[model samples]
Target chain A: MTDVLELRDVHRTHGDGANAVQALRGVTLTVRPGELVAIMGPSGSGKSTLLNLAGGLDRPTGGEVLVEGASLGTLSHRRLSAVRRRTIGYVFQDFNLLPSLTAAENVALPLELDGKSIRAARRAALAALTEVDLADLAHRFPDEMSGGQQQRVAIARALVGERRLVLADEPTGALDSQTGEAVLRVLRERVDAGAAGLLVTHEARHAGWADRVIFLRDGVIIDSSGPLGSADDLLERTS
Target chain B: MSIRHGLLALLERGPMYGYQLRAAFEESVGGTWSLNIGQVYTTLSRLERDEFVLPLPENDGGQRPYEITGTGRAELARWFATPIERTDRPRDELAIKLALAMTTPGVDVAAVVQSQRTAGVRALQEYTRLKTRQDKQAQDDLSWLLVLDAMIFQCEAEIRWLDHCEATILRRTRTARPAEQAQTPEPHPVRKEARR
Candidate 1:
């Protein structure tokens, strides 16, 4: 099967000339259906840049990024936005829910924007919320929910339309431990059901949820290891 | 350390043979702590010697059963009521290693902290994997999940501590070097004067 997300020797740089900052250098990764890959590194090690490139939110300076066998670079702006809307789901550290929208409305926004009927979008949103155990709170606005609950809604939104690729950046950064674990459980369940996921986190315990871990250093892919592999040597050098 | 109390707690339910007690103890703790039959028997013997348990008549197969005494019940109650003191915990080897590394000359302290952090992360991953494999019966598997959570939390705390150690070390060395140089006379001149 084609990978849900693939990055081949991806390079991303900001600015130009001698002053240009290479945010990502020669990083190659793939996330197939049912695989969850974690990107981990120190601050400013290009974790976020890699995620942006994968999501098509930012263009790579070199190499290719493909989603489900289609090259993102070749897509027109309208087509790229459509692909992002229909194929990708993103969960940020902050919930990023619109305060004016109720949970279900927030969740259904993506589907509606993609031109699904409002009724169909709402139905899908309710189904997604039920998957995350938040159906009861569908009518509640973002301000009415706790941080964890809000994050659950965000996850519900991400998974609403059968999006195959989920990208999360420190999705549990703001929550307490128990709440964080609860959110992670929802994320894990979705990925296990065949969604490919790419999570960027500084917390190793959070990365523990991933099937494999990619370690970055100075914009380069330094090491890749299984969840149980000994990281002492790599950690020593990085630390 | 809690094995003695664990056995007594299991016995509180009813009289149990050594093997039964071992199985019950392991089950109650979610099978994370495995108690050998020999260890169970030894603990039972000690409890009997202390009058915390009484040995009943042997069954046809010669399996000996033991029942908790009133004293044992009271002791178990007290154990439940009391808070575990920090001093009672074993010395933290990681903390000791970091402390020593801080003072040792020519030692790469950051490297030591990093190695420990990596090991801690590995352990956290193992615990998480174990948790994932567990049955989804939250009510029935609560004990095991709690034990796993404890390990995960401890590993996370260790990693945070290691990061803190590295940062503090860097900050101190950056700020302390000039002060030390100004305070101490050149060692070479002092050695020469002493030799003369």
Candidate 2:
């Protein structure tokens, strides 16, 4: 199957000449259907820059980014926004829900904005909420729910229309450990169901859910691990 | 991860023989820790000598069961009540290796850090996968979950340390550029092979 997301020799530099800081340096990556890729790095390590480029929110100064096989650099602004809404889903650290909107409405907003009927949008939104096991809470407002519930609502919003590429930046950062794991479990279930996931997190515990991990430093991928065929080797040796 | 304590905790419910104890132990930990019958028997004998348990009459199957004594009950209760301290852990071999790599001549400290980080991340990923699979497939066992959590947390800590080590080395190298330039710099690719 074709990759859902791909970044080829991508570079993003901020500012001009002497003040220019390279946020991404010739980084290449790919996320396929059912694959969850994690980016791990310290602060100012270009994690967000890479994620932004992948999501088409920021353009790379060099090289190409193809989301669902469409080169983002070649698309028009209108087309890109369409792709962002229809192809890629982003879950932020903050739930990013409007305080006044109830959970189902928050999720439906994206589809409604994309020109679907409000009734159809709401039906799809409830289905998405059910995917996250929050169908019963769909009527609750973001303020009425816990942090984890709100994050799930954000996730429901992101992937409401069966978006194949999910980009998350510390989606679990604000919640407690158990709640965070619950949120990740939802993300993992989505990825397992064939949505490619790209997670940017400093926490290894959270990144552990990914099928692969890319370690970034000084704006470059310093290391990436293979199939982890040695997991049994590790546990056996330790025991 | 003391098997003796584990056995005592299990025996608290009822008397169990060696084979039964080993099976129960493996089951509780979700088979992460392998225990042969010898280890189980040895631990039982030790517990017997320590007066923490009493040997019961042989069953019809010729298996001699052991029951936890009152002292063993108290010990198990104490173990459960007492939080494990960091000092209880074994010496960290990864930390020692990184420290040694830093001081050793011609050693690529960055490579060392990266390799360790890769391994650390791999282990963490494995534990996470296992935890998810087990949680999905089996009835939830708190002990098994706790064991997986311990491994996951340890892996996370090691990766974090490796990250810190790499950052510190990079910062130090940038600040002490002149000195580092005078020392062994990374050899050119062509020259590196030629040197060997």
What lDDT tens digits, residue by residue, belong to model 2 across residues A111-139? 99999999999999999999988999999
The prediction achieving the highest lDDT against the true structure is 2
TM-score for all predictions?
0.83, 0.91
Q: Report per-candidate TM-score of chain A alone.
A: 0.94, 0.97
Of the true interface contacts, each candidate retains a share of 0.29, 0.69
Off by over 4 Å in 2: A230-234, B77-88, B177-196
What is candidate 1's CA lDDT for residue B32? 57
Number of the top DockQ candidate: 2
lDDT of prediction 1: 0.86
Cα lDDT of model 1 by residue, B12-116, tens digit: 999999989988887766655677899998999999999999999999999989999999999999999999999989899888987888889988886687667
